[model samples]
Target: MKSSYTVENPDYQLSPKTGMTRSHYIELAKYLLEGAFQHIDSFDDILTFPLIDGKTYPQEDSPAWRFRSLEFEALERTFTLAAPLIHNDPETEIKGINLRDYYANLLYKALTPGNPNSLPMPEDLPDSTYQYTCEFGGLFKTLLLMPDTIWSVYTEEQKAAMVKTISAWGHHRTTQNNWRIFNITTLSFLKKQGYEIDDGLLLNHLQWVVSYHSGDGWYLEQTYNYYSISLFIVYTTIWNRGFGDEYYPEISKTIEKSAQKLMESIGNFFGRDGYINMWSRSICYRTWVSGAFPVAFMLENPNLLDGGWARRLCSGSLLQFVTKEEFFVNGIPSLGFYGQKDYMVQSYSCPASPFLMFLPFICLALPEDSPFWTETENDGFWEDLGDASTQTLLPSPGLMLVNHGKTGTSEIIPGKVYYDDPNYSKLTFNTHFPWEDQNPDGGTSMEYAFRSLDPRDLRGDDINFYLTGKTVDNDSELRAKFTHSQNMLFNGQRDGVLYRQAIMRQPPNNGVGYIIDLAEITLPGGVLRVDRTRLAFEYELTLGHFGLPHIDGVEATVEERKLADRTVMIARIPGRSLAFITYHGWDQAEAMTHDGNNAEADSSTVLFARKTAPKVNPKMEILITAMLHKMDDSEWTEEELSPVKDFTIQTFAPSGSPCGVQVNLSSGASHHVDYQNIDGLRTC
Candidate 1:
């Protein structure tokens, strides 16, 4: 098929081929206008709208959902009302057109791509919040899609300012974890808005996106979950939009194909129900489901969307989520169905981000004359399913699967399980070992690093840690209580180990708000061994020559090897319990010098140098067995064993990374290990 944009708009005439009646196009424009207006009232006074009422508010306490939504609404409204303007007034009407000038001025004043002076971000505001990151991307899309009449109103300077601000904002520090792909596409969309930006950021964005992808049409909502199924449509569509430019034609083609696969996956999100499963944080941002379908359709061939009921799926699903009270008052989405009331609070979300659901509306960008606009909304995924099954949609590297299981419990499950690393934005949480009386300040300090698919990934929280552990007969007894505080206790009993993990809610400034623990048992004569390994996905890991592993009561023989092309490090430990710790800003932890003298003030630099790691949030199904044996059972011996249990974890560490295990071998004899390579498990 020919390019849809052209077929629909040759000399701005409606295409005869699409068979769309003018009335159909008008209806869509009207619906979008209503959406824009509905969210208009939700605008807060923090960033875009000043507290006109003249009340000062702290950044955290400021009225949320400010100008972000207003900007997008104005832009969309400008076009919705303007498409009819051109036909209504043809004589000198161009300059007199109110909607065109309104949109252009909004683009100019609100900020357009490539312009630095667009709007100044407030100094006291915390960029870590979703407001800053999500709005930029959302607004960028609205500006990118402006029609020619609206485009004609802005000065080159205004557009440039919008582009510049968005590009630079792309590098804003993500929470400890960088879920930047979502924002990078926002940056890419700005680039597509006709701005010149650094190729490095674009390349970096692509590298990270390609790296974090779990497979198929799905990317990790963040890093962990049933699997990685984030704002796939947003990132893919925006990237495809920018990649379409000739500057990177090859990448554009590849991304276009990727976009197609993404749309096909959207078809699966619909079960017998009109709704998609709610998973991960930002449950408030439910329109992501609708937005994904439209974007997939936009990037892929419309024909692909034609038979698959792409538009219907988005329209119906969006309508359902909104009617269900899942979204906030301003029409911004909710963080999730479950999570800290404060964390999942709708106030944390921005209105523009939710308008991402308008992605399907892009199909409206089709000329009023196109068949796409004329099609009835009936018979789509939402219509037929009509609230079928509430299933978790898990899109992987090559396939998409839905779990008929229950939704994630916002009510914390009482049990102690280790969270080695928990990524909220990408939606993956994991755990490894436990340290007892470990120096609180001995290790480099880290924060609650998380990312929202929205892009402004944030990472900063300072709270203290209070860890409590106990052995119970079964995993059933490990739980937590927070009558006056936010507390979490992991509870689970498997084999001989009773395990629980807890995050004691700290006063707002402790920076240490959550604690993740791994519950393990040291069987009689069984030593708990800790595995110290580094894993990477999209980026390379930088190891400072000075930092060394800190393990309690364990001797290590560390060796590095290549697994095919990737590198891995293995360290065998002979001890009952082992703890491996790595910290940031270690040089500051203790004074040191290169010559073994007082380390120069800058010597601590290695510890603080920004380093990257692979996001191995890959999913696998495996049967893990733990057995306790006599020191000398190499061949055939009888030993106590824990009942085998099935668990699903992000199983791929960097190739060759130690499996992180603690073991006790007879005083000096090393225990031999055997394992099977199962097909369909996460492969190297």
Candidate 2:
């Protein structure tokens, strides 16, 4: 990868640890765009070019049209960094294309009234290209932020055309959620350029965006992931920065406060190793999460994070992805996070889509003298913080994050998630392992369900289960209650909760049926899942629990014991261990190996326990306690393992208690259940 311009500015300083400077980031942005546009003959080719090798993302009514946004993404960052610096330096051409001419050609093709290759303006009824509203937002934002370079380079005729195009898009109807930010951003830019803008339209969308804010610096965008920090918070901060306090004064304050809140909660998501959480969607837009840090720096708000920490975070996250061979293929970003894995690629992804990862370089738009470039970089949260156990409850997203700093492991127990998407609805998301997609028997931290199928047919439909609802009680500080339910049929009869049927290979005389209600309570390392099952017909039931990744070189061990009323299974690696204790409704425990269960690792293993009776009682409630912990690697007495060895769960009410079980720890601390008043339950 070669940069068009050399780093000649003395003000641009490199961070000692990350080896990243403002020039290096700018060079990266330029390199990515140059690679993307290398073969393009005209600006129109951006929409029609086939950048991806293996797959062709046609521009029909398919979801692939959204990939065109990638070109705009690359241009947005390239121009954002180039516009401010080009006027000061004469040799500013990137890959033989002058900044001014390149942007003008793009703008002319996108906004020219009768040009054959011009972009489609807003239409009353959205077509295949309607999703480009976000791209338009990016375009307008680039023009607004770099007015001297973008606006000054355009002829009066071209400026009129651009304004006309933006006016139509500003008033155009868009999706009510995050898409509303498109219109808000576009109109804000138009107003800055002296266009007569409708305040009502701006305020409506502005208020609509504000409505999605879920306090403590989080916003609900399809269930809160990186977008809460990257897009929502960054957009509002840009709005406030573009149109100072003179307009929407109160809203400016709200944006600042939200940015501050996000800053406070941001450290928990980034690992000490600088890897961002891989739990959510758009994993290819890798370093965009660092966009929030730049916003905090631009706002001069130390409360969000200091310059040194921001540099460390932004540079660390950028390097974490860029330094990997799997991140880029043929100098273009691949679809997967670390490699080309089809499981992580969503329907809307295209080859150019990964360039959106350049969003963090928006910080490069800041001047060289800004603290972001000049500050002495510090070791990020991972290195600065000591060994500690930290748990934070984010109410807006209904997520409880437990960070075991010493072991460099973190677990997120999500309280509310979109039912249709299992990525967010899993029992727990661990930072060390990527969630398995479409594999019910794999990647799940804990799965509780009834498997009624032939022993030989592992592919048989094993109706999966998920966390339906969760609530935290006002009285309980450490305890949160959750409800799990699944809908199935019984004897060909449709019922919401009961499933009664004969196994496919079994005789009609051996038919079985059951009605099940499940719930869970959180613990330090794992969750205690309680399933109350009522046998409508006699059949076999099995429950499985998967522990953390067991790498190839690591020493792995599994142990099982059968007590009078419970079956216990424990799996241990070097510094961590997982124990599954089934108190009732289980007869035997066994160890199982899973092939191709991990995205990063080669193979994995799990522990499963089956209830004792082939003919279970008509109505039975089962309690299974799962404990995951980072074991103390330091040599110590037997007393050290006592807490884990002596862990016990006492069920108070099989199906009703708010706190479903009284969990006794080896440390002599006991957790009581009170199921009546639960907290944190919000309808998705």
Give the whole-model CA lDDT for all candidates, comma-separated: 0.34, 0.57
Local accuracy of candidate 1 as per-residue lDDT tens digits, 300-387: 4666665234444554454444433323333223223211122232333433333344344455454543434445433343333321
The per-residue C-alpha lDDT of model 1 at residue 608 equals 12
Residues 341-411, model 2: lDDT tens digits: 66666756666566667667667667778777788776556564466556666655666676766556666
- Predict model 2's lDDT versus the native: 0.57
Cα distance off (Å), candidate 1, residue 44: 16
| lDDT measured at residue 400 in model 2 versus the true structure, 0 to 100 | 64
User: For model 1, what is the C-alpha lDDT against the true structure?
Assistant: 0.34
